[model samples]
Target: MGNKKNLFTLAYAKKFLNKKGLELFKKSNQTRSSNSFKSLSYTVLSSLILIIIFFSSPIINNFKNNLITQSIEVTNNSKNKLENVLTGKAIENEQNDKLDILQIFEDIFQYEDKSTSTVRLSASTIEQLFKDTKYNLKDVRKNKL
Candidate 1:
């Protein structure tokens, strides 16, 4: 091992040129000689196809049209749902017409509900409402997960 000189430098490379060339060729052949040609061709063909699709005006226009149509569809669906809720059609049960904690406090403290139509809420009723809302919020979070 001591007698063998480190011949990796350019000046000494010529002495082991044949051995180094054989090793490099073996590595190259193992990696990308014949078996990888088909894969390389497929990659180039796919890249060209993608580039063409991206550059083609007709394809670009079609993609834009599809996006616009899909967005319009989503907007129309949400609009219809909002319209249904506004018309009271979305409310299947009359029990769903109750207010939440924030709404209850706002209505109570702010004196927003001046009408004699609804009954005034007591302290026990408020406590019960808080408990019910807490349970409902927990149930909703659990369902989401």
Candidate 2:
């Protein structure tokens, strides 16, 4: 019985293959091979890129460190020049003026919350609260939030 079934299946497959022609089969095989080749090439390209970045990371870090050190040295030189031209008392007064300005800004923007009340609502109540508003779930979903 199994042999008969296998032979029937094979005969049907052969008939179908003949109807489709060898050209179609060849084209599909070529397409599959090209797709695999493309995937392999992409994998190799990405690996090469990662390897290059890995090998060059120390050089990049050294360049960044050089830039940071140069900036620190420049700032130190500028600070020394300023100190040379200014008296101690003048520098102390300048720092005091900066602190006073910062304090004024802090006072203007200071916030204190003293609320001690708590309110809780059920799911239905929450739904009702948003039923007539644009903040409903439907609107939120439409807005992709």
Candidate 3:
């Protein structure tokens, strides 16, 4: 932290990191009890990491659950409305709020992807797909809504 010099430039940063790595490697060979600061730094860093991991789980899980709940509700409401409309029951009830197509689209757009699946595409393949005709997503989604 001396003078807070700009050590972040690519080459300088790499050299600084490599130097720090060698210093830590050398320092670790010394008796752990002798260099209390070294051991303390390691302990503090590890504890901080563990604390972050512990505290963040509940918050992340809650957000994920809320999104899943919303998606499920949207799916169910769309299914029920489609059934009613198809059965010739016109929804004349103005009190009942109709689903917002844009909201559904936004939800899908901002969706939390939990998929662990890996997909690989080559550059030419991606370029070909990019050149393909873009279809209206609204048309298909609107039919369900």
Best by lDDT: 3
Residue 42: error of model 1 in Å?
2.1
Clashes per candidate, residues 3 or more apart or on different chains: 0, 0, 0
Of 2 and 3, the candidate ranking higher by lDDT: 3
**Candidate with more favorable, higher lDDT: 1 or 3:** 3
CA lDDT of each prediction against the hidden true structure = 0.69, 0.71, 0.72
TM of each candidate vs. truth = 0.23, 0.31, 0.27
User: Candidate 2: what lDDT?
Assistant: 0.71
Report lDDT (Cα) of residue 103, candidate 2. Answer: 75
Candidates, ranked, lDDT = 3, 2, 1
The runs of at least 3 residues in candidate 3 whose Cα sits more than 4 Å from the true structure, single-residue gaps closed, are 1-34, 68-145
What would the per-residue lDDT of candidate 2 be over residues 29-139, giving only the tens digit for each residue?
356788999999999999999999999999999998887666533224557558766755343232333457777777766733434486889999878878856477877
TM-score sort, best first: 2, 3, 1
* Candidate 3 weakest lDDT stretch, 10 residues: 68-77
